[model samples]
Target: MSKVDVYDVHLVETVASTTDVKPLPLATIDIRVPLPDELIHLSLEEQDSLERHIVRKMDRRLMPIIIVMFWLNILDRNSIANAKIAGLPKDLNMNNAQYNTCLLIFYVGYVITQLPSNAILPMVRPSIYIPLVTCAWGLMSMAQGFLHDFQSIMVVRFFIGVLEGPFFPGVIFLLSCWYKKEELIKRIAFLYAGNILSSCFGGLIAAGIIGGMEGVAGYAAWRWLFIIEGLVTVAVGILAMFLFPDYPRTTRWLTKEEGLFAEWRLSNEVAGIIDEDSSGIWWGVSEALRDPLTYLFTFMQMMLTTGQSFTYFLPSIIKTLGYNNTITLLLTAPPYAVAFLGSVALAYSSSKRKEFCMHICFPLTISVIGNILAMIVHGTGARYFAIFLMAFGVYVVYNVNYAWVSSSIPRPQAKRAASLAIINLMSGGATHFYTSYLFPDNDAPRYYMGGSALTVAVFLCAMTAITIRFYLARLNKKIDAAGGDAEAALRANKGHTETMKAFRYQLHWWTWPLPKALGTEVISIYHTSSKSADAAKIGKSNFIATSTEKWAEKHSRTLETILCTFFKNGTQLEEYILMLDVGGIMVYVEIPESALPPLPPGLITGNNFAPRESNTASKKEVLQMFKLKTDQKIKSWVEEVPMENCIEAVEKL
Candidate 1:
């Protein structure tokens, strides 16, 4: 009997014998089939184009929302400094120490909440969590306008900190979820540009509010600053709820195909490690705590934050340039504006070259020089130029360092989230608390002590960056040497994946194109049971194997000719799977019976076949059987065959 006849008879008998069990649905099974080489290439090209389109769409939809939110966040948080210059201290009866204490107190709430907030981020929708906190902080910021004394303002600031704490780290975590490592730094820089622009324009805005509204409606100018900025923040927060895209996996804005592609691309980049589950949050935290690099990076960030603390006392620093309230605030604008431009330039260069270390080292070294010049330079022009250097260096370092943390710790999403929060909390808290004391009211004209301290911090940050570069280098070497144990090496780090064998660390000064150099290798294994007709026909004979170029050429013609002859009516395979084994290209075709011609004399038709009992064939057992067959194919396929004939036979199967 023919195979089709035998299969039909077996199907009828199987249906009659099984009272409850139903035949497997075609939709439930993923049918694997071979495609023409040209089609495969076209699919890959289409996927690449799709990825670029998705990334662009994400940037358009997500970037502006985060930037605006961050702008409001920075404005609300640091408006206190502007308010301080506009008479907050005098109005509130705050001594320099009390003011510093207020800054420290805000960080007290800020520091305590970061880790927990980031840990909880995956469980709650960001659309809800982020805006809710934003609105809360805005309300708190506005409440600062009603403060009666040091204690009242301090309490308001504390709540503002608590509500504001999750934002920066949360945004960083959010960006990391959407962007690949190579594409991350630029996005981070753009997000931080909002912070820089706010600093620049915050002063200008504060100047306007303070100058024009000093006593409007019986409210102080500083009060007007807080109230206006806070209300603006609240309005923006409400808008954020409607604008912000949640995690890529769950975001509703993306089409289903785009979402899958986003997930697939990210999985491929990180070897299939994605952090989606809340159950892994604590585990991620533990992993972060156990990694020594976490502590090292934390220390480095602390020093960088200390050097960058100049932002808080910027008006004071510029006031020494012999400028009044409005002029000092205006002067503060230029340095940050210049730094904004510098940051974008540096971040773009880093992303393009795929280099992280030198970008950091170069700016930090320049910042140290700027600090030294600020301490010793006598001329006003030279001093102002020094401020420019200081701003550019510190801001660039801050931007790059944040990106570094995100890229270096690429694994278990929860751990990355926790690590970012912990690093930001520790670094920012220490800087706010301790660096506040560095520039007391007594050290006005040239805060030589502050400059010197910043010099040391910048220098230490550079050293730490070098240390991290070296550490990554060592890990990359170990990964390279792992050979078949590469997966084991990745597992040791808790992020092993099929695509990770070629992974390498991005080192600071390394000039190699790491991704291209490492290359991708894939192994395809095809398997079938010994009792199968195809298995009997082939008997242990190896199938075709060839180089990618030759195979592509050979199979391209074969598939083209076969389809032209057999599929002239435009019929095509409906259920098929395309598997790409990357490095050495190999195509394994599993032909369906309908596509083949009658069997030869030696091969038994389906009449000799027996359907496995439904009770015995549990889903798990069936899956195992399929896996065993695939494994056998992988092991047995060791010889080459005529590509044209194989294609013809597969088309006739």
Candidate 2:
């Protein structure tokens, strides 16, 4: 399934008199030609309406399913924290230190399969893939209820981590596949808020089951906690198998027109090439590995996830407020509930404002302040307020950064998938190996040791995000300089597509009215240097440059033509007021104010001798400026052309 994009030019012309040349209308320049058969006949406004309807339909069908799946993911992964307070430690004869080991083991198993699973996801149906793994996760989590010893529970937790490993990155990759970067952040927020919402409810669910279901059917309430949550997860997985949407190209629910538009719209974003089909799995892995951003994101995510170490111990931290198990679990819900609301609001802000770094850093700052205050403040009320600050802050940091990673490296779908997997593996799995120890028993009440280390990590997380923001901005500046696609832009020196990108291909076709003296007569001659240059070399080109100012200096009929250039909206010669002495007639060209374009070998390779811009630069400076010389001619100029210029340099009679 490969798509090759070829272009057709649709142009409009405005007649200009010898007195004035009006700029071409904007409709004359848009040339993403050969719109698909489904959309080609529609008016631009009608096409826009259809695109909106299709995207709205996609969001309606996909978002809820995505949210629920993540909710279950969070529910199954974090329920153990609630179980800790439900007396599972006493039954299994495990201490707080050993419980941390259980948490560490899950990550150990979780990291093992991530890279491999992500590689396979593109080839599989996500509707089938996500649910299948989820079902396995539920089975392992359910087994935790029957475990009797620390060793056995460790095995179950490890597998739970393994089964859940691919999910977060997989979902992000899935969403990125269907939507452009601008359209994706808010959706990611909903997905992330699902997990935060799960945390809020997991506590309440634990309180009810552990409080009322104690000794139910000869099982402890902690045992029932695992059983019930796992069962609900399994049920949710089955439902997803039916309702979950696949990739845009594969989703059966879309109309044929909608499906084509879905794929076409995404292709338009990445220069008419579909990302999923651009490269193979191993190639994508190589791209991800070679990129330095991957490692930076890994380090930053590791720090952020480490800051979130609090979530694993929040139940214990809450219990220190002199409350019973049920009340403590109930108390944990409000902070997370507040966090859920904040995460969604922050996501909306990030998407609407099109910002990521500050959105991430602000919440992390709040969490850092909360951690510092929790350590210094001694009273119950002061500590609880601190919890409120931290709860919302850390969750937003997590939600916002995920969208940042996806948007920053969106080309060649494989590269994005592998990079996400690697970042999550190191940040989510490897870091937890030590971060799990952040909340040991001796650090209870204040947990100063864990709190301080995590505060530093959270602070570093913010700093790293700030650094990444500047770094990505630098990358963007380069892309802008190269035109658009960084690698493809390298060919800008010679290729048609690349050249068009270099000048952004926006141009006006104004009929150049000849001067009155040339209306009824003709003149012709060739410079000695132009013996090799001819009309064949010029071909049918989009731009023409002319100057007649040199006619005044030439006595009779020495210079044949001063300058003749053909190009689209691009580079230029030196002064806008250039002229050529063609035999006895004068030829003048009006180049738009833009960066100068490269002159053909038939014309002189001279733009340096004349003053670049004059008279307000008069829409002439932004175009490529050119200079004329009789002795040396070039096929094309060596310098790269920026998109701002669209004036040509030419002379003939």
Candidate 3:
């Protein structure tokens, strides 16, 4: 009655010789059907995308506070060097040799407790821990003003060194936890710049305090410098208790959503970038110990810190140039000022470029050149240029090197913590022997002992930089190879969950996901039950268009292209799908009655699916859908299970 129209397509043939029409079977068993997209795992190109999603939201406020705190801390600790030039040695009655012993004793107490103190950091809040240490050191520094004899100076200095040892390493660890690995070097350099600025700040403070040579309440100007600066440090330390945030997860300053977001971002960033096998507390220590570069870093730090010991007496060294005490203190500012500006410039560029080795090496070479000039030059102007070079060269590498420490060991927070402690211990201990003897008032104008040692240290440090560069290059190559291997492995055992777990345990934490080459997916497979296996590898790729190299490449690949190409070539999407995670639910794509059968449900006819940019409604929708699907599957699966099988279901899930 209604034309009896057929909606289905059929192959028809007209009989040439007969009026009888044969009705052929409408469906054929041999008919080919496209596999349902539902049955086929739908993966997302999320390596770089996820990275950006996490990195974009990092809080920048902590950076300024941390930088300022460390800046003032270093300034106060090293200012004693400047005070000596303003006649602290004369007022304390410290002789040329007794003064050397005083410097030496400081390291004794400093070196012994470094490791122990660092171990205790996680147990106490940094806000409380750092400020308490600051208060203790402030008191010690204040007490330094009261020392009238060599023994008193020696005792006070030793205690000062002991308390100060934990501060730098503690700060480094805290920074590492908050920033992504790629973002860390620059931030670390910024914080370390405080050490550079301290040089200038110390000179300025000394110039103001000791310039007039007036006694404070019967105390010498040198004594007044310690008391006043110490009191200021104590007050700031108390304030920091209120200002400093706890760990990223517990920061009360941020909204609850913000805190969770921060943790999630870091987790995503670090997922494939680190060794899955190398997490937990013990793993950090083992990883740090196993890496030969850690010791090399130690050596680099030793050489650097040995040269830095000379920083304290720079004003005294300048005074030997025939300037009165006040002029010497004033003159100290220019070279140190040059250092602060130069280091910030170099550090900013170096971090921005993500080039650690060359940037650091350049400064070490410059430092060597500076020291050589200081020793060889006869003219006063040339010698002063040498000092400027010395200050600038040292500061440039100082921040870069600390960044190196944080970046090198990507786990068990303990390794980062321990290595930092070791660096400080070696630095402080080395200072005990090297810094005191070089600047004897006897050597005054030309500190041959000090100059020679600094020169040697600079040369050694340059060599150390070369070694580190070679090692990182090799390590980077290994990491690249591992990425390929990881992808291939993922493809070989698709749909298998246990294999993913094994893979996770075998890989390193900071190694990011492999690219679309050698069988790894260019897109991450959602709902695959193996996410945790590769979660440790998350931050392994370039996440931010602002920071990473592969951001554009990741963005250009569409979902349709990825699936069509993967199916056509059968090469497997090994690189992109870092892991498939099994969770509380699974998606079951539904097929409408009018849609094609034989093909599984939810098969799109067109190849038009594309990768979505981060923060898009599409991406958010996908995540939400996946979550809903997960919950639905879990509920259905549980509902079907018998009560007797409940334990088995829980175990399987």
For candidate 2, what is the lDDT? Answer: 0.68
Q: What is the lDDT of residue 215 in candidate 2?
A: 86
The sequence of per-residue lDDT tens digits that candidate 1 reaches over residues 40-82 is 3334336547778999999899999889999998888888888
Residue-level lDDT tens digits of model 2 in 1-653 = 00001111212111111211221111112224245876766654455677888879878888888888889888999999999998989999998889989999999999998988898888888999899999999999899999999999998998899899988889888888888766787888888888888988989999999899998899999999999889988998999899888878679888877887788876665545565554678877887787767888899999988888899899999999899999999999999888888888888877655677788888999999999988899999999999988777788767778877876665566877899999989998999999889888788899998889888999999999888876655544444455344555434322112112312211111221122112211122222112123221212121222223343234222222222211124222322223332221112232443555655543332312222211222112212121221134323222334445423321210
Candidate-wise lDDT, in order: 0.68, 0.68, 0.58
**Cα error of candidate 1 at position 461, Å:** 0.3
Using lDDT as the yardstick, the better of models 1 and 3 is 1
User: Could you list the CA RMSD of all candidates, in the order they appear?
Assistant: 14.8, 14.7, 18.5
lDDT of 1 at 108: 84
Ten consecutive residues with minimal summed lDDT in candidate 2?
1-10
Give the per-residue lDDT of model 3 (tens digit) for 1-653: 00001111111110001001211111100111332233223123332343345445444557776777777677767767777766777877877787667767777877877777776666568878888888888888899888787778888888988887777778888777777565776787778777777767777777888865467588788888888888888887888788777666677676554555455444444332321223445445554555576688889888888777677678777766778877887787788678777777876776554566677778878888888888888788888999988877877778777776676654446666766777767765755576667777777677788888988987788788888777655444333334324234433433111111101211111222212211223333322223323322332111112123443245432222111111212222232221112111111121222322232222222222223211112222333444665677632111357889989978986
The local lDDT score (0 to 100) that residue 62 gets in candidate 2 is 84
